[model samples]
Target: MDYVFTVRRVSKGAFKDEPGSTYFLKVPEDADDISPDQKVGAAGAGMPDKWAKEVLAAARSGENPRTVQPKGDILIYVHGFNTPTTTMLKRHRLIRAGLEREGFEGVVVSFDWPSASSALNYLEDRSDAKQTARLLVDAGISAFAARQTPDCEINLHILAHSMGAYVVREAFDDADDRPAVASTSWSVSQILFVSGDVSASSMSDGNPKSSSLYRHCVRLTNYSNPFDAALSLSNIKRVGVSPRVGRIGLPVNRPDKAVNVDTGAYYERNEDRFRDIPNASHTWYFFDQNFYTDVFQTLRGDVDRNRISTRAGTRSELELHVA
Candidate 1:
């Protein structure tokens, strides 16, 4: 049984008929050109039951014949604010490509939520988007567990960016409430929050040990750059506080009980490259090769002493107007 990858768009309210988005297994070199609407599974259709069955069987038996080399479970990605549907698809594809480039062989799923392609629309859909994310997470976890593959370990890794970070957090926080959704006692291996805007207060409001959010997560890695201007703007607009990746703030070694990854040093090392790329401030984590490499390494629990850097640094200059 090989890991089956699927990508699809889920829309809310009145916009349901607009070609329900594309989700498919990512291929090399052509990530940017693939549309979320393009079907990748059987018959050039949508997500097929056969693929789901294969995934469930593999999860139960721990044998995935589809992959070149048997690997762990799956990795799901959720994109951020002001991102169009096509852009989200491309980003997810690129992420899968990057992971493959690093020799990872596992199913990759991209959960696409409706975004209005405007800052105000992005803000308006935040809550609804979070709800969507919660549904997908629950479904993915349950689908894998119910079909348990005897020899394989079904682990889930989530990589969310900006506002998508909020979605991931909310899903984890609400996992226990959704009993209808499949439950996974297996801890989440790693949660990578890339330039996330979520506040520390919200993250720490509930008890660390008792909270549903903290119980499921093992290592929480936040990729935050002090030089990320968009994050600064988000901080001012949302909670009037500074941005902290992985919800860990500055002047403190850690945030209450969350693990933090300082991205300031990485930014400093690649300042020239970031500055050269237009609109690169908000997307440094994905755009920078070194940043992606470091994150991939961190998720694998392979700590390179050279990659560890400052957990806190000065905020970037505010460039985007958040009116």
Candidate 2:
């Protein structure tokens, strides 16, 4: 089976002469051969011409035309609250571009969930985006598993930031309940939640027997900061408790269930600065170069490279900086 890959550019803010965001698609790679425009624009295909043109243009310019085979391990990224489709694309491209700059190999996918520009909309979408995220994960996993070759070991990793972590958690949970999906021969190596806002109670609610999270993925890591302003506000407005990763009252010893990366040091250093709205404290995990270097090391499975000592009892800090 052949797969088609394309890269789409979207505008998160105003649609101007130059678009602000870009995202790549990892289809069969052979998808380049068939013009989505032709298929979608044909009288019977039923898709709008505008949509077809956009997709065709994206597919044609997404990657290096000369590059033949798919790149390294596959990584799927889901962005968090208040993110527009264009911002999601641009952020993914930035991450991919950075990884390539660091000499990493792999196909990076951005799972764009609909986010409205308004704060209220973002909040509502954050609550409702899990279903869409599940679909994205299922589609990506099924597509990759179906096409994987025996000689090549394909590793799937999910990296979700902030509210995006909620989507990942929900998707993983949902996948676990479906035996046909959960029992697949393919495995998800790791799930990295950066500044996740999910509550510990939500994670611990059901009996271990019925929990899909522990059953489905090999590892789950939560990176958190007690000082994350958005998360703090979210806690007050929504869940009543500070988000899971940075909750101050949790036990000093690591929970037997999930891997937690204490980000007290990072938070302590940048707390005052991240309190503002536009600053988006959580995003620093991806945008800052030094921060991203630590994230890269963690993704490469070199947790020690970027270790930080924290009062939270010497927890691994790299886990908090997912790309």
Candidate 3:
């Protein structure tokens, strides 16, 4: 079973965009059981308080006692825009499988915000993303951080994709505005962005737009792909918005802890294999073994950034080397 923390409203046996109470659900991995129209109600869900504790316990315990690093990690996955309930569930399963194949022993939890399945609801989705951003803090990250005692063996991390990056940025900024949340020692280890939809300039050093995100995470690794057509479309759709960090890479004045990995070359080399796939360049990282290998190493955080085997170049600017 996989964990799903959803904020989408249930209506007529389906998940809708309207706001609703959040649920902490333990869903099965069976593809036959999970469908876009299925009503995931009280039967599969746990009490909010109980599930939060369960997540923390899993994070603190090692999956394998024999491993040198006995401590565990928790990766909170915030998915991209235009993802339906079924797609979100499938991707959650895929992430766990992919990471396991690469020998990752950590737990993967998904934060499912209400994103419309239609391709034309970009503006609507962005608005919802901003509206729901705070829940990611209040119900997800902050809840975990508040419960974690000092010297805890677990590591908390976030892996956000596409417009999910915008949600993360807004969430951190909103959290900083609240005195209650700001006073807490809530922080994460690694903040990874895959095909992030936020602007490059906003992530630069000294930028007020993302200062809170920079302050909270130990490291920020952005996986950029110049060939991401979806982000290019996002740029165009936003009416001449600044270039996205996922497509144009980080700014020259990026934060000290921020690192950029240009995956364009590797994606370009393997583009043909994904020719028939939808949003291939933008979403291909989920299907790539090398990408998982790099992510596993990153989540481990034991190897030096410059020493990660699947990468080349300096810490500031690196190229993903296909294995």
Candidate 4:
């Protein structure tokens, strides 16, 4: 039997529902409930308390109802552009299942910001990501970090894919301490940026607009691929922006805080599995066993880059390769 899927969703999309004996509700992408548009519109939001009382509490619950504490970490997943809530839930479940299969002992929460599920709505999705960024930070990341424990600290890891990277980047507002603790007083352990859709130089050192991202996490790992088709569209559309971190990897001038791990070979090694996924290179990471193994090692948090067989780069950067 599979473990019960536990996902605390924080959505920024407006909800449509009728009050009755049974609830019938839906969150449409646009106000018209027809065509998608590029606008920052949000209906309502959720989380922080429920997350603390239920999801976070699962870590210690003797019953272990959701199997949240077996691994000792909280892995929050933020979905990327043009994703529907149902697809978001499925992806989150897939991630948790993969992690469990790979010996990860923890819980996975999906932060579902409203993204219309059609490529035509790319602009709309971008608007939604920016709108939901703060909610993800204040209600999602902050709430989990504030959870307390006596014996062991709850490790936090963020596995953000594609355009979701922008949301994660924008969400790091208050966390600013020795290793980027939130103003609410907590630190993220590892941020696993799988195919981040943000500009290559966004997180580089001295980029005043995005400096906080460099300070907070013990480590920032970028999982990149030169062949990400989805990000290819992003690059073409957003002409001025440098190549996405998902495509060309981060620039050499990036802060010493971030490390780039190239996984292009992993896709070549698992071409059949890549083809199995709808979008292949872009979505393959979710289905790839190699990806699950690497993510498992990252969450384990004991290995260093040098010992992991890394190559030195122009700056103080390391290119970590996963066999």
- Which one is best on TM-score? 3
Q: How many collisions per candidate?
A: 15, 10, 0, 6
**Model 3: which ten-residue window has the lowest total lDDT?**
32-41
**lDDT score for candidate 3 against the true structure:** 0.82
Ranking by TM-score: 3, 4, 1, 2
Error of 2 at 37 (Å): 6.9
Error of 1 at 250 (Å): 7.3
All candidates' lDDT scores? 0.55, 0.53, 0.82, 0.64
Error of 2 at 74 (Å): 1.2
Sort the candidates on lDDT, descending order: 3, 4, 1, 2
TM-score between model 3 and native: 0.91
- Lowest lDDT sum, 10 consecutive residues, model 4, at 16-25
**How does each model score on TM-score?**
0.71, 0.67, 0.91, 0.76
Error of 2 at 151 (Å): 0.7
lDDT of 2 at 182: 69
**Model 4 regions lying over 4 Å from their true place:** 1-51, 60-71, 174-183, 233-236, 308-323
Give the Å error, residue 192, model 1: 1.1
lDDT of 3 by residue, 149-204 (tens): 54556788999999989989999999999999899888899999999999999999
Residue-level lDDT for 198 in candidate 1: 73
Better by lDDT, candidate 3 or 1: 3
